[model samples]
Target: MTAKPLIGITTYLTRARWGAWDLKAALLPASYPAQVQRAGGLAVMLPPDEPGAAEAVVSRLDGLVLGGGEDLDPALYGQAPHARAGAPVPERDRWETALLSAALERGVPVLGICRGMQVMNVQAGGTLCQHVPDLVGHDGHNPAPGTFTDHAVEPVPGTLTGKLLPDAFGVATHHHQSVDRLGEGLVASAYAEDGTVEALERPGGGFVLGVQWHPEAREDLRLTEALVRAAVEGPF
Candidate 1:
């Protein structure tokens, strides 16, 4: 049998309650690993660790998934926190940033979802809109706390995301922020009807892709499958 591509997914360091255990935990939604496995790859949860450890972590993985979580510290992109922005998780911010850097440098396939996309943008020197509702004039992007809102997104033809999800598709969204100034070398590949950037990609290669929606929340696994395929094929 062929060796399955190993994919590392970043998780949240948060307090949770499960079976009478209320304590801090390294947590991730079960859907993430389920989707990864459905796509024929091995999934591993990567909790926030000390800075400088990402290099070692990335070295062993064929792909990386920067999962969703708290808002990034505004200081990361040289801005002050927005009144509506959620509290920052400094440890996760540092670790994931380093992970993104190391993965990019090594040409590992990367898929960024929700806040993961934001992290990728900020790491690449991009800024965020902070509170998207202020610009779009609606909370449709994030209708509730801990619940996903439904919205349609159109993928730009000729881009990687467009090729993978060519039609205008519905997605589960739950974010109050959106991409503002895109990162250097990153191109907007999709958008919501209100013009919010829904997807971004590094042009000219290497499977660097980010989406504002949560694919794991849905049954479609094309995006995850793409990452697995890229990992299985090795570096471009």
Candidate 2:
């Protein structure tokens, strides 16, 4: 029997104070691993590290999933922090950037979610809003982070995402920051009525899709299935 495809998920660093030492440990939510397993892939949590570490992780993985969390460091996009930049986690930002770059170059199927969406964009020479609420003058995106809210988005007439979710409109959202400037070679496949890019994809590349939503957090399994299919089928 063929072995299951190995899917690597980028992990976050957590500071746990124990004894006299502040433990810097790798952490990720359980949903990601559970999602991968449900989709028939063996999930591996890849911790953020140096650039070299990113290459090492990519080499052993059949596919990559960029999980959601935190905000990207402003320095990555040649900008100063906005008033709402929050606490910058440079290490996680750096590692995720390297992972995205390496995965694209290696043609590994990649599925990015929420903050993962922003990481892919920044890695590809794009920029973000940093804090959408300040710029947009509203906070509709994150009405309540954990609650399921529906937002209307129009998908591009012809694209991978369009093919997956083809209709007049679609729903799902929970983000404060979003793509402000698109990355080179990426096409905005979907957009919210407020003009935030909700989904993105590379025209003729492998399964390189990013969604500004937590599909794993939802009860639907189709999103996870699509990613696993792409990985196992060796990216279209």
Candidate 3:
């Protein structure tokens, strides 16, 4: 019998509050695991460990999802932090970056959401617009503090993103940073109305894709399904 693909999702290492206690925790949003499970994949959380431990950790997974979290250190992409950028999570940056490289080397399907997408770009020699509002002149991408902003994204036809999403659609978004330069061998697969790069895909086409939105926060399961499918069927 075929077992469900084991999907590893990266988590945030930060102080979280629950059960009358506030403490540092390795946690991911419930929606991430729920989304993976709903897509017929086994969900596992990958917390920030020693950066050197990533290869070993990734070797055990069928797929990898770089879950969204804090802003990456500007040093990662050779830039200084924007005045508006939040503090960096250096541990997460190092761990996730290593995990991404290891997963890519091993051909594990990857789905990068929000900050995850930004990480992928940085790891691939790309740059970021530290302050998105500086580019778009508005905070529409991240309209509220905790609430999601709704906007339309147009996926380019013939790309994996386009294949899964197929056309323009409204998506839930909450981000203040964006890809400023295309990564090596990566293509911008989708875009927002203001020309913001909303999605990216690796050229070799082995399920290495990233989107600048929270797929878990929405009802659509196509991205997760595609990751699981790739893990099950071996790259398309």
Candidate 4:
């Protein structure tokens, strides 16, 4: 029997306590693994590590899934902290950014989710708003923290996400920040009613797409299936 495609899902290494001198550790959402497996790919947890760690993991995996998590350390892009910068996890940022670069170079199919989506943007020379409400001059996309709310996103017709998801869909959101400045190679493919960049992709890359929503958290597996299919069958 043929082995399932080895898909690497990036993780966030975080310290449980939000204090100085506390030991940091790795933490990945369980939904990611379940979703990937449900979509027919073998999911492997790839923890954030040194510069070379990404390349090592990419070499073994046919696909990459950048998982969701905390706000990134703004210093990665030479920026000062915003009021909503929260706790800076330099180690995690360094690890995932390096891994993302490596995965891109290796031409691995990539699906970035939430913080993963933001990392993809930063890796391609982009910046974030830190907090959408503060920058957008409003509060709707992210209403309450740690809760799921639906937001409207208009998808670009004929794009991967468009073909996979509904033409105009309500996606679950729980992010404080949103994509402010776009990156080098990505094209903003979808947007919220308030004009937040809800989805992005690189046509030049094999299958590089990022969405600022939690698709795995939902039971409907179409999104995950489409991603896995794209990786296994190549972007069409």
Candidate 5:
């Protein structure tokens, strides 16, 4: 029997309160692993580690998943921290970057969700709009803080995201930030009604896609399945 592909997902390293203990823990929403498992991949949580440790970890995994989280520090993209920017997660930022760099170097399939997508952009020398409402002039993309809002996104044909969601579909979105400049070698594959970049992909035989929404939060598992399929197929 063929082995199920191993999917490594980065988890948030933050203070937590659980079962009579409060300490910094590496935790991820259960939805992430649930999505991966439902899509037929073995899910593994990767905690923040020393920068040099990522390459060895990537060498063993079939694919990588960067899950959603807080707003990123603008300094990484050569800007001062916006007043709305979440507290700096320097460790996570460095750790995820190392993981992404290793995965890209080894041609491993990657699926970045929400903040994960932003990390991908910055890692590739791109910038981000500090606040979505400031640019779009509305709160449609993210109507409430800490809650997802439904919005339709039109996917461009002939791209990774487009192939999966060819038609405009509603996705769960809860972000205040959006991609600004296009990252080198990255293509914007989908956009919201307000022209907010909804999805991005690296056009190549390998699977490297990022969506500005949270797929795991929704019942739709197309994106997760695609990542598993890519892992099974290996690099092209």
Candidate 6:
């Protein structure tokens, strides 16, 4: 049988509770691995590691998924912390940033979601709006704590996101930060009705795409499938 592409997904190192045990754990939503499997890939959970470890990790993976989590430290992109911003996970920030750098160097396909999207932007020397509601004038992008809201995003006609989801499509969103300055070599590929950037991509990069929504949270596998397909097909 043909081997399935190995896809590595970043996870949260947090204090999680399960069956009367509350301890530090490396965790990811079950939806992520399930979605990867459904998309015909082997899913592997990648927790935060030492500074330079990402190079070795990326070298073996066919693709990478920067999964969603806490807000990035504003200092990463040269800004003060906003009152509305969540506390930063320094280790995760450092590890993931290194992972992104190595992945880019190796030409590995990447799919970044929610906080993942913000990480990509910040890694590319771009800035985030911190509190998106402050700019969009509403909390629709993040309607509640730990709950997702539905919103439509219009993908640019000729971009990767647009080609996969050609029209306005509803997505599960729960984020307070949005991309402000476009990242180096990154272009906005989709936006919400409020003009908030919903997706970004590097046109010349091999399958590097970031969406400010949670595709794994729902049954829609189009986005995840696209990543797996890119991994299976190798670099463009």
Clash number for each model: 0, 0, 0, 0, 0, 0
Off by over 4 Å in 2: 16-23, 145-148, 168-172
Residue by residue across 205-230, what tens digits does model 1's lDDT show? Answer: 59999999999999999999999999
68-131: candidate 6 lDDT, tens digit per residue? 9999999999999999888889999999999999999999999999988989999999999999
* lDDT for each candidate structure: 0.94, 0.84, 0.94, 0.83, 0.92, 0.93
lDDT of 6: 0.93
lDDT of 5 by residue, 82-129 (tens): 877789898899989999999999999999999999999999999999
lDDT score at residue 133, model 4, on the 0-100 scale = 84
lDDT of 4 by residue, 62-84 (tens): 88888888888888777899876
For model 2, what is the alpha-carbon lDDT of residue 77? Answer: 92
Clashing pairs for predicted structure model 4, backbone only = none
Candidate 1, residue 21: how far the Cα is off, in Å:
1.5
RMSD of each: 1.0, 2.5, 0.8, 3.0, 1.1, 0.9
Please report, as a residue range, the 10-residue window in candidate 6 with the lowest summed lDDT: 227-236
Instruction: Tell me how far the alpha carbon of residue 101 in candidate 5 is from the true structure, in angstroms, after superposition.
Output: 0.8
What's the candidate order when arranged by decreasing lDDT? Answer: 1, 3, 6, 5, 2, 4
Clashing pairs for predicted structure model 5, backbone only: none
TM-score of each: 0.98, 0.91, 0.98, 0.91, 0.97, 0.98
Name the weakest run of 10 consecutive residues (lDDT summed) in model 3. Answer: 75-84
User: Over the stretch 1-236, how does candidate 2's per-residue lDDT look in tens digits?
Assistant: 87889999988888766578888778887988998999899999988788778887898889899998888888889999888776788888888888988898899999999999999898889999987887678778888866757777787787888887787454657777899999999989888888788989887888999989777876667667888888878765
Candidate 6 Cα misplacement greater than 4 A, ranges: none
